[model samples]
Target: MTEGVDPRELSDEDLFRELQHLHETRTDTLLHGSDDALERHTSRTQELEEEYLRRYPERDVDPDRLRSGARRRG
Candidate 1:
């Protein structure tokens, strides 16, 4: 959506794939950038996730409980 970055040049499927790739690439870059930047980003993400979990407490479930559910019992 930026200037001179034409998605129109690609086929519909190619454009969609490219967009997905760009999103993942940007996410990877932000997640693994310089130590300070990565720490700040992680802190912000943790804050947001904690806020969301607090707001929707029922959505927060233990990972052990989830694993137990996935385990098969004979």
Candidate 2:
């Protein structure tokens, strides 16, 4: 897990990489870690996600479309 650096301070590419790393850590915790570990990962993932969305609102995903399996026309 990355430490010390603030997500909001990261460059776009770095932030996305951090987000990807968090997702992977969360998945790993869910599969093999203690409940506490999973919870921490979940919380951190949410925090990073919120920051990412705040920084790049255009990249935000629509919850409704996500649930309905709809794709953006681009």
Candidate 3:
């Protein structure tokens, strides 16, 4: 079993740091990690991201990322 801290238990700064690190390594993990490692990474990412959304329900949305923005660009 991979013992780990719950994302909810982390302070905001620590949570953000963990999330950042995971995201930074995502592509490499996807391409190079073993199946179990990739699975663990995916599960951990979900835990952290879900916690982040729960913490900030009204998180900012960038207009440039909206569907309308993509339409305009096209």
Q: By TM-score, highest first, what's the ranking?
A: 3, 2, 1
TM-score of each: 0.48, 0.64, 0.93
Candidate 3 regions exceeding 4 Å error are none
Clashing pairs in 2: none
Per-residue lDDT tens digits for candidate 3, residues 8-35, read: 8999999999999999999999999999
TM-score of 1: 0.48
Give one digit per residue, the lDDT tens place, for model 2 in 1-74: 55447767878898788789877676678899998778777777777788887977897576656735554433
Indicate the worst ten consecutive residues by lDDT in candidate 1.
1-10
Number of the top-ranking candidate, with TM-score as the measure:
3
| Model 3 weakest 10-residue run by lDDT | 1-10
lDDT of 1 by residue, 4-56 (tens): 23433545565456545544555776866787755654554444445445555
lDDT of each: 0.54, 0.75, 0.94
Leading candidate by lDDT:
3
Report the alpha-carbon TM-score of model 2 versus the true structure. 0.64
- lDDT for 41 in candidate 3 is 94
Error (Å) of candidate 2 at residue 29 is 0.7
Local error of candidate 3 at 14, Å? 0.5
Query: Residue 9 of candidate 2: its Cα lDDT?
Result: 81
